[model samples]
Target: MLLGLHDHWQELCHCHVSLSIYLGFLGAQGKFAYKLLNDLFANYSNALRPVEDTDRALNVTLRITLSQIIDMDERNQILTAYLWIRQVWVDAYLGWKKDAYDGIDSIRIPSSYVWRPDIVLYNNADEQFTGSMETNVVIRHDGQVMWDSPAITKSSCKVDVSYFPFDGQECRLTFGSWTYNGNQIDILNGLDTGDLTDFVENVEWEVLGMPAKRNVIIYGCCSEPYPDITYTLLLKRRASFYIFNLLLPCVMISFLAPLGFYLPADSGEKVSLGVTVLLALTVFQLLVAESMPPSENVPLIGKYYIATMTMITASTALTIFIMNVHHCGPGAKPVPKWAKKFILQYMARLFFVYEVGETCKSSKRQPKVRVVDGRTEEGGHQPRVCATGLCLCRHGSLLRDVEYVANCFRDQKAAQKRTGEWKKVAKVMDRIFMWIFFVMVFFMSVLILGKAI
Candidate 1:
């Protein structure tokens, strides 16, 4: 009984201490700071209710951004700040803050979070003579989210009597938050899907600093897996993904087709090999395009692949054309005369002109001849016989009689039998086709090599 009485006595002392502090400062006129501490800090003397135990520690990890409001000297500013009180916390407490109305007008922001002053221009001159801030943060999904700690406290809610000292306008800040089940706010609270969207509620804010500090609170949490909270931030990190599956692989395979050009066309294997590679490329392209989103902008590499394949296809076609032109005579085939003319002039120039010059050297011979005087009354010159069929004979010579003439004619007929102009024309055409085909081939080879490089 004595032990129990001693406990009661301690409780009475705590109550008296709390009541006296409140009453003594009831008419307190200047902006004052008051802190709401968890009963756990009161030595548990009157900790009539124990905090509920929970499995998850981090329920809703909130990244709070706070700023200081300077310029209010009003003392009756009934201000309050709050945080979603964590259950069974080791040390949880609430605090009221100060507003910087002193007009020091200088800010020294260090690497640490400390009290400072504001005013001036930089990012929009709105903070006029100051800097705005942006930061990235990670937090756990704890269903128990904090109220705009810049408000008055009522269990699950927060209300700030007055905030934003610089502005005379009055407004209310309301938060949208999750409702709780047994140990945490179940996702079933908001959306019908039972996904975390159920807890998508706004956590509002009111800013002030010093004297009547833009009253604020730093939500308490320093753990992981936050068992009780339903919306798992860990799960969300893996959820955000893209569906360009077909696009990715197609890009890579199409680029591989250009490797076909490394083969030389002269190698008898070139034609069949090129055709096979083209077919394989076509199949792979079909595979890559299957999963792509039907859209306007194809992947960057897709266009490149298309260009390269088209060139290779064209390369294959030209190879076939060159081989046919080389094997078949242009006159015998359906080749146009102008095409033959152009090719012969430009592409076949060296062969046609050079071979013709060689033929002229072998067939035509300029021989030495003597002009002789004949026994006619007037002086006359007679042409002499030469090796190249250019010569003259006396009109009345006894040896040039009918029998002699027949014998000479027979010899000349045998010589004429050895030559034919039609044969020469065919040989010239062959040489012309050969040279033009080679030049075109060289040009096309350069074009293809350029594409590969």
Candidate 2:
């Protein structure tokens, strides 16, 4: 039993010894990490370019990942976006021996404690031009440093809203070192295009693609070449919002303009309807103007609204003329021969317009038979009839009075007939103009709005 107890004691002692060794090793490793940080920054100069040779140029690889599109100001011609920016470069002064530093292959430190490239957006439109967030730098044992940060970039973009609401835009974001010439620092595109793997989709705009290009230009101020990387972000506007809010309402108003002609002239609402439609189109045009810049190029929807407004104005003027013709009185002049031939006959047939009945014509009064002074005579005149069926009348004061009354009644009947014909001509012309305006509105809408489809 004593031997077995002795064996258990030995095993317990061995475990205690091993635990002590592990705790000591862990403490030593913690001390080494602390010492490593101190040694790395002790002689490091953050302001210098971290290069051993002054003649060799540093190459910086730049990459951007679009995270979100915050806002696009078309009026101001600016694009605001949230981006993930990555910069990689070699810092010859930041290298360390992994074995001497307790096998630590990489380290993370505050970026302010190291020399960094002063890369900036060339087309910045924001008050705070350098928009990168201060982040840590990751340094590997082989003298490579990587910086990953989030940036809110506001860049100037030339806006073309000719097809607006259904338009596509290509905005560019140019990046390069602000103070460094090509001999001091050269910029390189890390990829052919920007990364979209983590992009958050925006409701108003769709990302088509982002392509990067490198340019080297020699400015007149300096003999050294300035290199830059430009990223072109192609975007298409999502038209669903504008279609429901702006376009569909305008189309409804366009259809309403033609309906003004269908209103009866007697109702006295035809001109009012046309004027209301014109006002509605004007309101829509104002809405379009509010969203777009004051540019020379008008939007497709704006053109459509202008055309519709002009049609409504013309329609309103024609409605007034039609009402004038419809209300012709006995004193008004007769409709011309051409108006009767073209509008009353041909146009009436074309528009399928017809009078309700032949009641519009006055019925002729029959001559009364009377016996006066012991003689049978027609009521119209006292005359002696010859064998040729012609009557010769004798002039007298009573006969003259009767002929004058008959002449007045005959002139009244002819005036009433002419007034009716003029009204008929107005009805036919109204129908013809309605169809003409309908055709114009239809073709104009198709030609302009069809581009969206």
Candidate 3:
């Protein structure tokens, strides 16, 4: 029993010794971290740059990763985005030997305790210029400090909306130290291009690329060069939204303007149809204007709407004229000889139009002979002989009465013929104008909208 008790006592002693050693090791690490923090900040000043030599410029490397595109306001010319900003620099006073600190190689500390570069976006448009969230800074034993901050930035961007829904835009985000010149602090790009590995896709825009460039320029006020890093975000509009909502409807409505010519003049709706289409195009133009900025450069879609409205307006006026020509009465003047030859003859033949009961075989048919009051009439002219082969001079009173009635009939027929010729001229003009306007719309659509593709 005593031997067994001795064995149990040995096991307890071994466990107690192991626990004490592990506790001691943990306490030592805690002590080392506390000591390092005190030593680093004891003589350090956050206001001064963390450099060994004041004459030598401190290099701060900057890197940005796009997280999401929040919004792009074309009217206001602003670009809002979420980004991950990383800055790396060396602090000469923050380094320590790992052997003296329980093999501590890195530590996390509040950023306020260390010096950070005053880098800011130069073209910020928001009231609050800086939109970064403060986080802890990582310090390595070799004096390297890394600060990763998440920022939601709103920067000014100049937008060119001439092509509108089919347009691509390039916006730049310029970053540099606000107070430090190139001689005091030099900024460097970690990579040739901005990082986009974690970028969230936007519904209305597609990111073509983001390229970064370093620029050093000297202002007139200061001889020292001010350095800046510019990241250009190249974006293209998706265009599908505008295509369905605005462009397709306008195109369909534009074609309707030409169809107004096909409507009959006597229908009384020809002019009304043209006017309604014109008003619809105007409404569409207003919709486009509401979305775009009030700029001098007109959008491609807006140009099309204006052209369509003009054509519709002209069609309405011509429709009114054609209706007037169709309603010519017996008192109206006869259609000019030129109109009969050009419009009624050449243009009528071109448009495959002819008077009622007139056809290709009508010219070959035999003339009709009519007997009126015993007087035979051949063709359209009255004959001088009676149908019974008797001398018409024996009945002088009856002959005089018949001759007066025949003169009245010829006058009425001549008036009716003049009115028919005028109606035919109006129809031929309508067909010619319809085809002309149709061709105009076709070429206009091809030239203006084709550039988008």
lDDT of 3 by residue, 295-364 (tens): 8989888888888788888888887898789889887898888887888777888877766677744532
Cand. 2 Cα-lDDT: 0.85
Number of clashes found in candidate 1 = 29
1 versus 2: better TM-score goes to: 2
lDDT of each: 0.32, 0.85, 0.86
* lDDT tens readout by residue for model 1, 1-453: 999999999899668765654554334321121121221134432222122345532123322221222212122222222222111111122111223212222111111121111211111212122222311111111212122222122111111212111112222222212222223321112211112211322223222211111111223552221112121111110101211333333334334333333333345664675576567657655654453334454533344346546755765665565544434432343445665465434444444433334542353443443334432222334544454543343445642574466656655654332222222333334454444434544444354334322
Models 1 onward score TM values of: 0.27, 0.84, 0.86
Clashes of each: 29, 0, 0
Alpha-carbon deviation at 67 in model 2, angstroms? 0.6
Cα-based lDDT at residue 258, candidate 2: 77
- lDDT of residue 3 for candidate 1: 100
- How do the candidates rank by TM-score, highest first? 3, 2, 1
Candidate 2's C-alpha runs over 4 A off are 1-29, 358-408
